[model samples]
Target: MERIITVRAEINLFDGSRSGKTTGYKSGIRPNHFFEGQTSSIAGDIQFEGQDELALGGKCFAIVRFLYPEWFPPVVPGITWRLHEGLRHVGDGRVLEVHSGR
Candidate 1:
């Protein structure tokens, strides 16, 4: 039998305009989550993590430990503000959508 679905998905793409274009990477499988920013402060769904200084807020800490120091991209700075398309609550595992300042 064919699997039944109730909701339709939207197509999100990343335009070259820089700052998240009020959109996302086009025509790709939307990742369950993406890197919010690079800083001591993190806010998003937790992965393999533990308690630390940046972990005080009870939310996911920014994943700065795993990235290269020189890889700091302009579009993605050290700190970013999380974005919510709908209802968002602390510790809800929502990703911070920092306005991509081009």
Candidate 2:
């Protein structure tokens, strides 16, 4: 069974990312979540605050939904994570709240 989870976090996209120059990113973007020592990407969706486009490279609070939250290590406040596209590290974030989980 899929136990999806929602988490609120403050994210910052790397200024060097390919899409980093884009003015804004829409919600519902599927970015891989990578935590410490993790070698694989955990599928997740990002819902930016206000459900509107958000500027990259700036600290932005967002709600992320993990499709396989159980596959990840225990998520708690202050735990940092990285967002990736394939092998490229696009952004980074810190967990603020675990809204729901398995």
Candidate 3:
């Protein structure tokens, strides 16, 4: 069986000039994951640490759980990615740790 993949990542939400989200993101929100140099995105859920919401243009560490773990490339520390709502880029992230998940 394929083990669910999860990671600890450092996320940065972009501001309006970058065509990012107008507001902010809350924990447990599912967003598409676009790995570096990749045009397409994989499905995932991000839960921010501590705060209930991460404001636009804010940076924080989050736990990311990939919904379809098989669709992604090998995740490792220092590899970067982006978070999207549909095709719109909203945030950026860098993998800090990878582990098995439920």
Candidate 4:
């Protein structure tokens, strides 16, 4: 199955606001920053395996991987894929933007 670049997901830091039953900001997902050496938290590395491509019910497309919680419902189809070096039309990229949350 051939494929191409279709989507990209940016996994960024998040802070939450606690209320009644739910405890999160509608803005984005909460990221664990510091180590209190306590409470339930998500701390791990995300690595991409296999090729960076996706298909829509058999149509070729690109897949980008986002660090979405497994418990989260499948909001959409396909995935976030990673691009390789010297592979094709893709370039010697540069840092477009970055936010160092301190």
Candidate 5:
């Protein structure tokens, strides 16, 4: 069975101040910024351990993990940074397709 999971990338903005404040616009709240060029695709396998009906029907839950790049451009306040986008198969197994919400 094959499954495609689409995901949108977001950056969490936090204030560097010791007072634990969030940096954003006048609202003091930062919204999730979805960009057109900041998306990744990861492929992996889904293994079921039991005979549950949902598992058999390919409806079982899965958790996929991946590593982000060690180097990224410097972040600027009030600006969302999106570097790359598209689908690239990094491995072979079940397929998980991630798409960026622009």
Candidate 6:
């Protein structure tokens, strides 16, 4: 079975221009093992709930892919995952919240 998890992530797109270009590093959510050979990005709107207090770059609805049932690990609510920087996992704000996609 295929499972797609939706997460409300606080993504920090490096220090660069937001001019409709894919610039800067996406500092959040290490891609699940299922999306090994495929390219993906979190697409969602910018949330401003706690912008001032947190000073986060922006918030968005990131789609986390778990192509198979076994691909997903036991997750705890409100636990943040580090972002992928090339082969390394760095940074923070990759909060995951699983939804029932039945």
Top model by lDDT, which number? 3
Model 2 pairs in collision: none
The global Cα lDDT (0 to 1) of model 4 is 0.23
Q: How close is candidate 3 to the true structure, as a TM-score?
A: 0.85
lDDT of each: 0.27, 0.77, 0.81, 0.23, 0.25, 0.39
lDDT of 1 by residue, 1-102 (tens): 112111111112223242223332222211232335534322222222243222212333232222222344433333333323233211212223332223
**lDDT measured at residue 20 in model 3 versus the true structure, 0 to 100:** 46
- Model 4: CA > 4 A from native: 1-60, 75-102
lDDT for model 3: 0.81
Candidate 3, residues 1-102, lDDT tens digits: the string is: 244578999999898778545788889888888888666777788888898899888999988887645545677789998788887988889989987652
Give stretches of model 2 more than 4 Å off: 17-24, 69-71
Query: Model 3, stretches more than 4 Å misplaced?
Result: 1-3, 69-71
lDDT tens per residue, model 6, 33-101: 312233443322223233322222434444444333433454345655544445443334455565534
Model 1, runs deviating above 4 Å: 1-48, 51-57, 60-73, 83-85, 89-102
**How many pairs collide in each candidate, listed in order?**
12, 0, 0, 9, 0, 0
Error of 2 at 80 (Å): 1.2
lDDT of 4 at 13: 17
Whole-model alpha-carbon lDDT for candidate 2: 0.77
Q: CA shift at 51, candidate 5, in angstroms?
A: 3.9
Alpha-carbon runs more than 4 Å astray in model 6: 12-71
Clashes in model 5: which pairs?
none
Report the alpha-carbon TM-score of model 6 versus the true structure: 0.38
Indicate the residue-level lDDT of 100 in model 2: 87
Clashing residue pairs for model 3: none
